[model samples]
Target: MTEHTDDTDDTIEGHERELSAVREEHDDADDDVSLSLPGLSVDRRDFMKAGAAVGAATASAGCLDALSGGGSADQETASGGAKNHKVAPGELDDYYAFLSGGHSGEIRVMGVPSMRELLRIPVFTPEPASGYGYDDRTSEMLEEEGGGYSWGDTHHPRVSQTDNDYDGRWAFVNDKANGRMARIDLEYFETDAIVDIPNQQGTHGACCLLPDTKYVFGVGEFRVPMQNDGRDLDDPEAYTSTIAAINPETMNVEWEVEVDGNMDNGDGGKDGRWFFTTGYNSEHATTESGMTKADRDWVKAFDVPAIEAAVENGDYEEINGVPVVDGTRESSLNQSDRPIVRYVPTPKSPHGVSVTPDGDYAIASGKLDPTCTVIDVEKLAEADDPADAIVGRPRVGMGPLHTAYDGRGHAYTTLFIDSQVAKWDIEAAVEAEAGSEDPIVEKIDVHYNPGHLIASESYTADPEGDYLISLNKLSKDRFLNVGPLKPENDQLIYIGDDEEGMQLVKDKPSYAEPHDASIVSADKIEPADVYDPSDYDAEFVAEGDESIERIDDSTVHVKTYVKRNEYAFPEIRVQEGDEVRITASNVEETSDITHGMAIPEYDVDLALAPQDTREVTFTADEPGVYWVYCSYFCSALHLEMRSRLIVEPSE
Candidate 1:
């Protein structure tokens, strides 16, 4: 274990505080003889440690042992024991799940079966602990491109595809608050680039990739300027449901199209010779003037014909997904040249949209309605009358938010108001004649308001996973009272070949409020575990990294490396009014080896993974001494990785 220089008083003080906190927690747990709760994963100090990842980082993608909370038993009731998902510490997880840390503007990485939180990937917001917003390079990404604004609300995370399966190449997430789309390279699991959806103010249902990985789409959440500035925000009819296609290779704007009226959030799209995404008022709502409850209720009964007609007659001109117009509203919406997107309206304030495995049906769920609206894609494509394209709106439960398909035989829809999961046979219900058993098969109750339930491999071409994680919004009485704002509980459930029911297995406490997640089998990913200087890419990225340097009298470029048992950096000395830029890279050569740097009294915390680089620029306005230390725990001597920053008084 090594540090930048001799330890200072600030360094010692911070180290003592962290050690004391850890010891107090362990000591308190030791006093409690029994650690049991109603349907919670048993607490294990060993599993909670950060080192549990060092050994299991190379494990395969299919272990059936129960871990964390709950018992692993093949039970048949609500209170039955969990199925076989238990595993030892440092054991490889069968899958890797990436969950959006709602308002925190980051994504949490967890392993399936064990339900261990392995990593937190910063996305739209400034994560000081990970040096995300502090790193000079990434700090720019957090802010609005044309403005000084930073911080964003990230909602959905969708992994890229190869052959319709998770290719472990890219993961796309949406910034609902910023209307920005980000691409995370799976090789390093770091956000490489982010492209703003031009002409839109906010984004919701975005980053849905096509089957062949040719193009990914970003749909605007709100009806804003839509490239036409100064549009009256009060007029909902003036707003448009705008969407754009981005070439995956370049991650640049290819072409975009729009239709009139508020379409809300979209879905992970499916294209069978053509692209499709059903609409919903999913937070990224309309700008209708003083939209009354009555107006919303009236809008709930949407007319699919108007939507279909608008899309069909959109007068689109661009071909092969190319950009061919000025970055203006009229130029973008020439009406003579726009891609048409068919709309099929349904009851129930729709929130999410999904397509079945066979690409036969597109399902949209209304959060306030008691049923979900289904649109048959194949039928719509071949229909002589596009106005009559809605397949059915099967009554399920109140407030259906999102749906996950099990490529095998069923679809699971999360009912928010009722806190239940409604299961139905997709093909059976889509093709079943009325009065037939009604494909509405069963219902399972979860702990609290469940926002999203991801079936193993749900978003893929085939669902090969046996676990289902229900991301609940409210913890309620599920776990011990932490505070007024309880942690989000992501409960793990077994959704195997059992024709009976899915059983609750574990309760994993989550950070912030998680929105949506992406999980693929571990075998599907092959990220290099070592830090290769050649792998680093971003603006101002240095080929060979080193510790502290004085680029100029008033400017400093400090580079550091984070490795197990050590964070190497040189002493930092600056005068008041000096602009300090720190470029920190984690050059560890092992999988899951990550480090973070945090400077006291400054909002500079960043996560550095093997070969990943981030830079932070800050002006030393205050004259004082500050301590720099690693925020993420990576090794037994992680505490030893510390440095001192001395800001001398200006003359």
Candidate 2:
């Protein structure tokens, strides 16, 4: 209807400007909204722009997303949960600090108290099969009748315990010897349930997480016949090893991973990282079927040809196609003394594993070598190849056995060959500058039998109180190679504060073969009161007299020398509402020794340094023969340093 004016270019330019203006306005609105959010109060526009800048900067700096030092999205999610719980930053620091030097020489460093070595309860005692008139019967029959037969005649199975949170009164014991896991009530110490897991023959090294998680992970049986046979590993039937996942709650086999090799011992971290050893390809003994003496001798003379024939005939195969070599047959086989497989070195019997308190990394002690390896847990979880997941090598001199890390970033490792415990300063290494040439390991030596050490963390009531509990499994006599089959004594060595440096507070005897331990709170049980000798009837004695004479009704002082380096407590009898006081002194020259006392019925623990004394007060409300013993780890006779307190009825 009107004259058409061709203004197409002008119209397009004008529309473009309008669109840009709208985008700017939207960005402003987004910024306003973002700036008003309570927790996320950053401007949206600014944040977007900053993100772009950061991306550009990171790209220019040649950084990968995975290798970036910043935390990942998963960490953000985990922190979000932590934040929602309103955990104070200071509290988190305190928690970590408590796990570090706080509980230095005890079983638990923080959180819930762990169980220390109270006593080792034997589940079986065998008599002579001939005397029992069972010589004609099989060993299995005799064991079956014995009621506690576990693993035929062997009883060196690893043991671990965990308390049930839901039932509160129940605890579980993973009895590797019996190929069974059993549940026992904590209050009564009685077995409630026992479940036998399949394919658990020759079970060792078992552990579990707490609460409702009823699963226990451990190493499975080794195919002894196949392993013992000397054959080429290229055959598929040469090895048979597996890792078992057992559901202790239901006593069922949940899952298993066939490793197809020898997995001797293993340990699991709290974060689900498991460390173990794998035997390398080696030759083993073999007995051929339908073969005469000549054939056997020929095969023994030339193993390679025999192995080839076996592989060709499909008569047998190496387990996992890996050879099993006997350590004793190297000279006959014309093999070098060095181990086989030079490049991809097999993990030869990895025994002990310990994770960092933060669950970021783990250290595994290699049984075949003197060095220990570190594993980056996050990288391992995401890695396509497990062999490549090991982070670094921290050479621990001699044969390393157990590794433990406190929250303060210090790692402790034990050397089995020399019974030495070495503490390494990991924090300094972690904080060192990137690509620095400084060495990371700092070693401090202590007395320990490296082959068997159960590392644990613990904390104390005093602010500076911290400890590390090392359950030394080998006794001095055994290490020295001189004693009557001394079953390795459990030594609880307390590494605590000493003016002469960090000295051992107690190195006392404990339950036999105390492999692993935990801690529990004194107040968790009934009888919240403490015990003191002052509130009880007093007695007096001459300097050298062992007998006591009752002097006062409430106070007792014994003049006899309590003996140096001894934990001695006087026997006391109290009624239901009576109080007790006891005093002790060390006549020895030791300056910093700590002698402590505990009444399990009343849950009282008291400690006094050498040449010093302390007192405790408690009401004997419970009627029982409560055993009072030294809480401190003392010397060889420490187990004998026990006295009984008799709580009687009040008239």
Candidate 3:
């Protein structure tokens, strides 16, 4: 995926389905046959193999099967009338992928088995159709330092969990360019809150939540010279590469501590009683550089001190004061002055690290090295006296950037430079003899430069690792050239037991640059439908505001309600040159049934969550009819969820 800027037009808003080009590129598999054959349970590779034997007619029949990332449901066609009710849409793909929309500052929701784009949640960016930055309710959220920033370069998205498992309540994403994090309520599929990380200038590798979502960790990618200027990067203690741990409930930085090395970015952390981070670039130089052993690559751990523990110790007076918050309530919590943290060396350029499902080990990938390292989770947790915490290092392949675990004790590492993913037994490696050769169990070749490999993976106490999604950075010859910059490729790989093998199942194209993604089961989230006027709590509006009214002849106040596939509110009829104030309320409670209001050509778009009311003001300068419709794809009637604003000439 590529980095899009705030100035990008509305063209990037649509969910991608690069079907025609994918067909053109893989024409050799395009056989012509009757697609109405019996037994619709054919898998992805079965479609291709069947085409090879049954002629071109069969290839053309299952073309959509290839486009949809391969599964039993794909054969259903648009009418969705295929007799196979076993693996239909909303059945097999009970999991949803929340991916970073890169510089677009949006989060794309994709169904797992089908890879279908569900909804686009606007956060740090100004979406004209959703009226995110254009509307006052969300306008203030995008402001950087002071004033405001237009777009975001979003990087990591972490789903909140309970007891270290995906509970499906909310998802948190970070804006690398802006040093901020935002929360998305999964049930409503709407952005609920955003807060800035303190002491961090550049937010990168923010694998925020640990087990049970106790905290979201963040560190500066490029540490600014805090005390030393033009000096050696050797001063790891003085380096400004500080990692901030935020309280998920209050959105407060409960603790901040300087990492023990000079690093470019602290990739991500694995949670348990002890939290850990993997990173690169300690003792780095711009032009003059000599890499030391400790500076080469490293994995670190931080012990999250509870509020009770802080009080028990009675003011570690030398500690810095805790951070303050700015939201619905104004409260301050004390930041732990001295948090217990430790680290050990690893292969060069360790980027992504994760804890295994059974809480047995922590796995990290080295981007500059061929193999990956698996450290004992038990040893890491009990390392109070020891300085080094490494358990075993297994060589997998070239440039292993990240690792994903399947609940059945297998860890899959993505090899970026090698264009492959190395799967191995995590427990075996963790228990292997030191200095012994540990080889990977399986290596599946992928497209060029696979960045992140996501399974039904979560940073919760319990992990679900059934399937994998390879977010490949390049789509080189996979599709027709849109221009110079190519489309991204994401493939579905099944990690189930029994008959199905560990192979590529489905492949599809993602238009924008998607950096990282996280998945959650559909059952965990509860969305809303239909918002009523009585439940609205309006803090952003004038004192004692009513549902609907005419303030004066020049200005009118209108209240509107929205829900699934329809709107139950009145249309505004105002005179030309009159000031208009519209408050739109989304009355919804069903999971993921949010609504949007977009007045195209008028530069007005608003995102309304269930029982949420937001106001937007614009002048009815000319006499014309403006159409308002839902910007985000909610369901079958998204396009039909519309209303009209008729502007009459002053008479």
- Which candidate, 2 or 3, has the higher TM-score? 3
Single out the weakest 10-residue window by summed lDDT for candidate 2: 292-301
User: Can you write out model 1's per-residue Cα lDDT over 514-559, one digit (the tens) per residue?
Assistant: 7888778999988777556665464323335565667778887676
A best-first ranking of the candidates according to their TM-score comes to 1, 3, 2
Model 2: how far is 39 from its true place, Å?
A: 55
Indicate the TM-score of model 1: 0.73
* Reference-based lDDT, each prediction: 0.60, 0.37, 0.60
Model 1, backbone clash pairs (residues 3+ apart or across chains), number? 36
lDDT of 2 by residue, 1-651 (tens): 121122322332343344233223323222221011111111212211223233212211111111122321232232222223233333331121111011111111222112223322222221221111111122222244323453221212222333321223333444445444544333423233444544444555454532234455555444443443465455544444444455666545554433333444444444332333333222222232111111001001112222233335443323333322332222222243221111112233355665555555556665434445565656554444443445555545445667655445556666554344555555443343322213234332232343444333321111122344455544432133344443443333223322211222223333243354333333332211222233223232223544333345533332322433343435666566665544443333464445555665675554433433333445667777988776665667766777777877766
Model 2's alpha-carbon lDDT is 0.37
* Each candidate's clash count: 36, 56, 42
Higher lDDT: candidate 2 or 3? 3
